[model samples]
Target: MTDTTDTAKCPACPGRRHPRQYLCNTCWRSLPSTTRGRLARRDARAFQRLRELHRALAARTPLAIIRVSR
Candidate 1:
């Protein structure tokens, strides 16, 4: 029998997606910053959520630099 638990495709793209979500990574990443599309307006929260994740990934650790001098 086929595995019925497999996730389904994203509504905006042709990629499998999380069961609880309607968007795949590709769609999430491709979402425009401005709400100019019909789908974008409907999935605004998902787009914003992915945007935050992207931002967090792009952020860097602010480690202090030290120098030892004689």
Candidate 2:
């Protein structure tokens, strides 16, 4: 058996690289955004939720704070 695929060196560090990937898993998600003009998954999800809330408010929907756990 043998393994063959394209690979690239991660600019963050030098070591094992993944196929067809510029950065390793650690280095890839280690930063805020994996690439430019991109938002982190968590951030993107939060923005979506905020947009929904704004839309509801514009539509005259009442919003209340049931609880503030944070």
Candidate 3:
């Protein structure tokens, strides 16, 4: 038998849950206001989606982010 419920450690912050979120709370907080504004302005929907995807990645949700146009 094996224990599979262990939470993975964050690459940037050892022994932490990595915030299990987009860019991690620390990184997100550290981002420059200008950068945040830029990200907010360009493709707001895509940016929001990216954040969700990043959260999924942090949780090992087995998902990928891609772009498509029609």
Candidate 4:
């Protein structure tokens, strides 16, 4: 299979590059509205969940704790 995608530079990391990535979907979706501006309410929820997971991992909490509610 062949992929026809253009490489795009990640907005957050100029030195790093991605193929056909726009704001690198993961970062785009994770970005808080306060940082990115005017995000849908649903996207905000997803962003919050991402932050919570990050916080838990940073605090060395077990993955079990993070997955309990999910």
Best by TM-score: 1
- Put down candidate 2 lDDT per residue, 23-67, tens digits, no spaces: 467654553332212322345354554354345435644333211
lDDT of 4 by residue, 24-43 (tens): 56555555445334222345
Q: TM-score for all predictions?
A: 0.37, 0.34, 0.30, 0.34
Which regions of candidate 4 are displaced past 4 Å? 1-42, 67-70
lDDT of 1 by residue, 1-70 (tens): 2533777655544567776653566655554434223223434365564454344334631111111111
Q: Which ranges in model 3 have alpha carbons more than 4 Å from their true place?
A: 1-21, 42-70
Q: For candidate 3, lDDT tens digit of each residue in 1-70?
A: 1322434444334433333333445544544554444434546465565565455546654222221221
Candidate 2 stretches greater than 4 Å from native: 1-6, 33-70
In order, what lDDT does every prediction score?
A: 0.43, 0.42, 0.42, 0.46
Task: Name every residue pair that clashes in candidate 2.
Answer: none
Top lDDT hit: 4
Q: Specify the poorest-scoring 10-residue window by lDDT in model 4.
A: 61-70
The reply for model 1, stretches above 4 Å from the true place, is: 1-4, 33-70
